[model samples]
Target: MRVTMIGTGYVGLVSGACFADFGHVVTCVDKDPSKIERLERGEIPIFEPGLDDLVAKNVKAGRLSFTLDGAEAIRDAEVVFIAVGTPTRRGDGHADLSYVYAAAEEIASLIDGFTVVVTKSTVPVGTGDEVEAIMRRVRPDGEFAVVSNPEFLREGAAIEDFKRPDRVVIGTEDPRARAVMGELYRPLSLSDFPVVYTARRTSELIKYAGNAFLAMKITFINEMADLCEKVGADVQQVAKGIGLDGRIGSKFLHAGPGYGGSCFPKDTIALVRTAQQYGAPVRLIETTVEVNDARKKVMAKRVEAVIGDLAGKTIGILGLTFKPNTDDMRDSPSLDIIPALQAMGAKVKAFDPEGMREAAHLFTDLELVDGPYEVAQGADALVLLTEWDQFRALDLAQIKNRMNQPVLIDLRNIYKPAEARAAGFLYSSIGRA
Candidate 1:
């Protein structure tokens, strides 16, 4: 299949590259000249594990290409995917669909023959109908089927997820569109991955509902961690004991600062706004959003409880990205916790293998050092914000000797309490008494 993907952002780029690797001819289009130029020059604009090599391999095989103008590509393609960003709208909290609508209009004008237009971006329910209406308004006689096909790719492991998805949800009633989508994902279908064909609205709701549930799960475990701490219990063992049950398998059960990333924060708020607009509210999700926000704000107080006074103290931060393998800093917990520590009069020096470049733009007066040991040197306390693989097995004794005070606050609970205590350091962790 010949496919044209609009927007070349994280979703667009990753999906387009993966589709090209599946032996489809793909042209990724973007309005930004710099982004297209960078892609064309073999320089990836984002930090995703193995994405650079995947893009390079597919491009070398003549299956993937990048462009600024998509007119010719759209006219020749059998499938046109709108993979643009649907960020949360300001004030309204609904998904901002201007970019999706704009792409639909452009595709409507350029498509020559019958085309299957798929919305691969995470969007609110009923967005497919609005996109179809917009396309019809632009080209009344155009023979195109607008379908909803939301992506569920995780940032760090997008390629693996795309290749071996838990399930593929395709939303369309048109037989031709269904056939086209089926052929597009034939590789997965052949590998026995379930492809669910459902109504467009249901498909859209599935994306939001899935994300909201995961966010709730993370929040639930976090609340349990708090209770465990007060009641002299360990959250890790608690998570392990319950996770062995088949009904509630352990996935997002780790107790951390909170859930913060591109999807959960924006999607949960959008779902709340959508439900209220329909006269049906999800109070649990509303509470989840509230609790997660409050959790990130008070994480600095945990440090204060240990060190007594943060005034004129130097703190060392281990990680800055939301997760380890991706350099995405959107709504990361560090964004909240770092500033709160600074406001309480503690200067912070941080290090992350991949996130420092992006983190530099989000923080001010932040000392971004070259290595973890540099962050530990002369610091009053060492805090592990994100559990990068390198930070897991650091020389605890060396770090203890380098710091002004041998204090370790493991926010992600990466270290065992007894080990830190035996290393002659004042240790504190989440949900372990």
Candidate 2:
């Protein structure tokens, strides 16, 4: 199938590349000249594992291309995919659908024949209807089917998720649109992957409901971690015991600072606002949002308690990005933790394998260092904010030697308490005594 993918961000770029890899002719269109130029030169603008190789392989085979000329791409395309960002609107927490609607209007003017216009961006329910309405208003004679096909790609493991998705949800009753979608995802369809066909509204709600549940799960475990800390119990054992039940399989059960990323924070808020607007409020999700926002700030206090007086103290941080393997700093716990520590008079030095370049602009006064040891040097305590694999096997003795005082706060719970204590450090971890 010939596909035109609009908005070459994470979802658009990954999906376009993967579709191209599956033998479809794909043109990824972005309004940003620099982004399109970068993609054209084989330089990907984002950090996702295996994406560059996939894009390169598809481009070499003449299946994938990048361009700023969206009209040209849409004119020759059988399917147009809007994978633009639906970020939360300022003040209202509603999904800002201006980009998606604008893309639909522009696509309406350019599509030559019958085209399946798909929404691959995570959006509020009823967005497909609005897109369809906009297309009709812009081009009365145009024939197009608006289908909701929300993406479920994780940042670090997007390519793998795209290829081996748990299930593919295609929201469209239009037979032609369904057939086109089926053909587009035929590569995955050949496997055991299940493709669910539902009404457009249900499909859109599924994306938000799914993210809200996962966010709630993470918040539940985090709250359990707090209870475990007070009751002198281990949350890890509790998670393992509960996770053993087949009904509640262990996925996002790890107790950490909180859930923070592109999807969960924004999606949960958007869902809450959407549900309330429809006269059915989700109070649990509202609480989840509140708990998570407070959790990040409380994490800083945990660090403060571990490191006596923060006045004139230096603290070393191991990770910056919300999670490792991707350089996305949106809503990362470090964004909250670092500034809170600084406000308490502790100078901060941090190291992240990939997040520093982006983190630099967020914190100008922050001392971004060369490596872990450099961050450890002259620091009173070390905190593991994100669970990067490299930080898991660091030389403990070297960290102790470099630090002014040996205090280790493992927020991600990556280290054993015995091991850190034995290494001559005052060790503290989440939900473990």
Candidate 3:
């Protein structure tokens, strides 16, 4: 299949590269000439685990290319994928679909023959209909089928997820579009990957509903961690016990600052807005969004509790990105926690293996350091926000000696409380006494 992927953000880039790896000729189109130039020069904008290698291999094999001209690629493509960002709107919390619609309009004018236009971006329900309407309005003579095919790729494990998705959801009633989509994913189909064909609206809702539920689970565990702390119980044990049950899986059960990333925060808020717009409000998800937002500041309070007076303290932070293996800082909990700490007059020195460059642009007052030990040097307390592998098994004694006060606050629960205590440090961890 000759595929043209528009808007080469995380979704577009990854999906395009993976499709190319599947032996499809893929051209990733972006409006930004600089981003397209970077891709053409063998530079990947975002950091994913195996994406650089995958893109390199595919480009070397002549199956993948990058372009700034969507018309050039769409004219020769069988499948045109709109993988643009559907960020939360400024005031309404609804998904900003302007980019998706813009891409649809451009594709409507550009596509030559019958094309299966798939919305691979996470969008609100009925967005496919709007996209189809936009295409028709722009070019009434256009022959294209708008299909909702939302992506489920995680940031860190996007390559693995794309190559071996648990299920592929294709939302379109057009038989031609279905056949084209099926052929596009035939490589995975041969491996028996489940491909669910559903109504367009249901497929769009599935993406939002799945993200909202995961966000709720994370918030639930975070609240449980708070309760466990008050009641002298361990949330980890609770999570383990309940996770063993087949009904409730263990994924996203870790108690941390909160859920913050490209998907959860925006998607959950968008879902709440979308549901309320139709008079079927999801109060549970609304509460989830509230709790998660408040949890970030609460985490700063946890650090404050350990440090006492924050005015003249120099706190060492171990990670800046939302999670390990990805440099995305869209709505990272650190964005909230670091700022809150600074507002209270605590100077922060942070280190993240991949996130420092982006974090530098976001933070102005903090000092970005080189290594974890360097960040810990002369700091009052060491706080672990993102559980990077480098921070997992650090020299505890060395860290304790380097810090001004021998304090360790493990928000990720990566260290044992007993071990930290044995290392002669006052330790604070989530949900464990």
Best by lDDT: 1
List pairs with backbone clashes in candidate 1: none
TM-score of 2: 0.99
lDDT (Cα) of model 3? 0.92
For all candidates in order, the CA lDDT equals 0.95, 0.94, 0.92
User: Mind sharing the TM-score for model 1?
Assistant: 0.99
With candidate 2 superimposed using the best TM-score fit, by how many Å does residue 369's alpha carbon deviate from the native? 0.7
Residue 373, model 2: lDDT of 92
Cα lDDT tens digits for candidate 2, 319-346: 9999999999999999999999999998
* Preferred candidate (lDDT higher): 1 or 2: 1
Model 1 worst lDDT run, 10 consecutive residues: 321-330
User: Model 3 RMSD to the real structure?
Assistant: 0.8
